[model samples]
Target chain A: MTDASLNTASTQTGEAGFGDYFALLKPRVMTLVVFTALVGLLAAPVSVHPVVGFAAILFIAVGGGASGALNMWWDADIDAVMKRTARRPIPSGKVTGDEAFAIGMTLSAFAVVFLALATNWVAAGLLAFTIFFYVVIYSMWLKRWTPQNIVIGGAAGAFPPMIGWAAATGTVSIESVLMFALIFMWTPPHFWALALFMRSDYDEAGVPMLTVTHGRRATRVHILVYTILLAALAIGTGFTAVGGPIYLAVAVVLNVMFLIGAVRIWRRDEVMSEADNYAVEKKVFRLSLYYLFAHFGAIALEAGLAPFGFGGW
Target chain B: MSFRQEHELHKRRFGRNLGLGVILAGLVALVFGLTVVKVSNDDFSVETQASGGQN
Candidate 1:
């Protein structure tokens, strides 16, 4: 082989490995799936055996990973240009696109079928839709075509717990739908806040994000609007069988703090936003991560106490 | 539209695509076999504590 050919082979071999394959799964997002699916399993009115529940969460996590892998595969080109995602499995050549695509497509089918076998058809169907939504709807279609990508695409991540709920109950309920809505509503604000700080990333990559398409000021305003809606939905979660005074208190405090941050961002100048300073934007971004976790954490708390009649029924 | 690196964009020949289909089908079958084995041996009716929030 010529020197250039040998080098290409070396780069491909070096890039594709077990770790890279695993990275394609996006473990951080998978963690959210596990937690939310667990909560859904716990929150359901019906009960599942411990072993079955464990299996359910496992398959759901696999499904989430499958979605991530497919997303990485499809977005590899865009990801290579974006600094934040430049090191991803496909982008780095650590995983061959065909391998990543194969893994993703394979896992999607596996997870959906197993979820159905282990639990019910409803849960399996939800998993199937979630995968399709993320890959076909969010990644392929919505991403390049519009700025509303994150708003609608976020629903893919929101379905796990509902899938878990259906696994246990074999049906959908207001509770499950609300859980889905909580994430769906929370996603735009959560992602838009990050988009504000990383506006340049979207611009250079030409992903047509809200900030890139509408500018930072518009993105901030949208973030605040979505944050308002998200905060309201979060606090509202406290009123159902999932809520109590403790959960209510947590929501009020978190939402208030979140609102203050959104307002602060709204007031900041583009110069200030683009600066290296992390005080305001950093807080908002970090809070966005914890915000969803805290909400779910409170839900878990309510469920744990509900059986004892400690928290509200 | 663009390949991240040389290998990621290797055009899948018919043989490669067929191989992928077989591998994916095998994985589904394997997982299904394990699931059926477990279900037959273990009681699925056993219930435990429900998990999260008001619902």
Candidate 2:
């Protein structure tokens, strides 16, 4: 591990600022965590009080941010090497590793304890497990070990909705589990598409991403296979209690578009993808961002309509 | 500024920020403790019985 003082010494001017601290939180990732968790909370069979709902989401976001900070602290070295991550607070010398570690630990404790207080221990336990999984299991262990890192490490990201569902109902159910599976299945395709375009970053960093280890051909095959499985799971979710016409429609459209993109990616050779600067891969990655939000948004819509006769079949 | 002065300034700033963070964390913990007490005292049956009686 790089010493914090060494990092600080390397930057002769300007100490860490507020923005640097916020960057440590990875607000972009936290946004997905908050939105998906909110959907989980809202879609549960029981309704949560507005205050409790707000508090639960807030703490969950904090926990997500804590994981991000801890990840940055641990991956500062690799992050410094990866082009996509070179400008992060720690690597850019705007924040010290010690500061990030302290902040991450403090916020992790705060978020878990407050969430348990606001809702139930089940949700808190899940949140704690998520932080542990991301920081220890994923960042520290799997990231350096194997090409299947994202495949298995995706579980950390998949837990938020389940946590939210547990917060609302104090227990897990098929609906929450299905929500988790949606993200879990989506992770490989989403990230592999990114790895397709940004293959060199993983290569230079020696991170052993699938694109680096198994080659893009195998990664492409994995993406298509996962997309097929994801499409089935996503479409099937529409018939459950949480599903409605709105969710089903969104799922069908998104999955069709997603499958087409995956097929395009799978068919393309390096020459073709490079000819367009991996435009097709980039499009698939961008579409995936909307893909997840739309599915969750549709689920939220279904939950909103459940009070009337219009929601589920 | 001299090197010594700059070092002292950084030290002061770090101390201030750490103190503020600790204070904020303490406040959140206090609120969380209070919320746990309030939630535990809440009566779910009151709402259930009220709705049932009204019906």
Candidate 3:
């Protein structure tokens, strides 16, 4: 090979840009982490300094991103096999697995230590556990072993809001747990809907998704069951300290719509799904996103209005 | 005149280096701000001998 060609090849493969490293952090998931954690901080009864709150959220997001990097490193093999994750930094060859591992470890330590110094040890400890849970428990152990992987692994994603509340109050509370529960229960149905449409990806990767392990019919039933439970939790949260009139209204409307969507999903067979390209499933998935965002938004609204005498019941 | 073209790899490396530099600088600023906030808060006050005597 000519020097020019060698140089071209090296440029294409040898070094990754800033964006590639950022991609290793799974920025999309970080958005959810940041948002939920912010809501947790805001919804807390105790007031935190703006700077401290910002730093807490930043560290939580970094901790979350660190776990994402580790998850990508551990799952690089399956990620390559699955079309949905084939383009991830590790799988696409933009970043090396060792690099991902190193980054994950370094950032995990940095985030936890900095969080302890900035906020309280409780929040920092929770962040540490979240990273360990997502990487070691969820990614390494459960993901390949069980069809209920997403169900159990969802806990890692649910901890940020609780961590945020702890950052403010230095203790856990029912309100924070309710926020955590909202996400925890919502994760199964949200992911299952996506799995229904993208069944082949998990099957190809041998990930043992509910759809692949128990058939699509069973997966549909699981979706409906989880959604019903989630709806109950979402609406019930309306009466909690975190909930207010506005929150109740949002929860009622969204949960009703979510229930209708879930029922529709449960009733449809594979033939009906394929005929419409899983349109209903996709729509429900989209609504799930709105359902979560609106619920959290309502909580934030309640918190925002609290001092003004219009927020809580 | 002696001239050499910078490889594309060099540019990417430069960008990565710059990004890390910015992030490190931001961390320094954040730590500084946190220290200031902690020190200014009443809970963080150190009790001097005179203050302890007064109490």
Please tell me which predicted candidate would have the highest lDDT against the true structure. 3
Q: Order of candidates by TM-score, top first?
A: 3, 2, 1
CA shift of A67, model 3, Å:
0.1
Model 2: per-residue lDDT, tens digit, A1-313?
3333344345433466556788899999999999999999999998787778888998999999999999999998878777788788888777888999999999999999989988899999999999999999999999999999999999999999999999999999999999999999999999999999987788878898999888889999999999999999999999998898899999999999999999999999899999999999999999999999999999999998888867777
Worst 10 residues of 3 chain A by lDDT: A3-12
lDDT (tens digit, per residue) of candidate 1 on A1-313? 4322332443353424345666888999999999998998888878777767877898999999999999988987778777788778766666778888999998899889888888889999999999999999999999999999999999999999899899889998999998999999988888887887665678867897998888778888888888889888888888987778778888999999999998988888778866756468778989988888988888878777877878655
Pairs with backbone N, CA or C atoms under 3 Å apart (clashes), candidate 2: none
Highest DockQ model number: 3
What do the candidate models score in CA lDDT, each in turn? Answer: 0.82, 0.90, 0.92
Residues A1-313 of candidate 3 have per-residue lDDT tens digits of 5322332243234588999999999999999999999999999999999999999999999999999999999988777777677777776778888999999999999999999999999999999999999999999999999999999999999999999999999999999999999999999999999999997888877888999999999999999999999999999999999999999999999999999999999999999999999999999999999998999999999999999999988
TM-score of chain B of 2: 0.64
- DockQ by candidate, in order: 0.05, 0.14, 0.86
Q: Which whole-number lDDT from 0 to 100 does residue B28 have in model 2? A: 78
Give the higher-TM-score candidate: 2 or 3. 3
For candidate 1, the per-residue lDDT at A274 reads 64
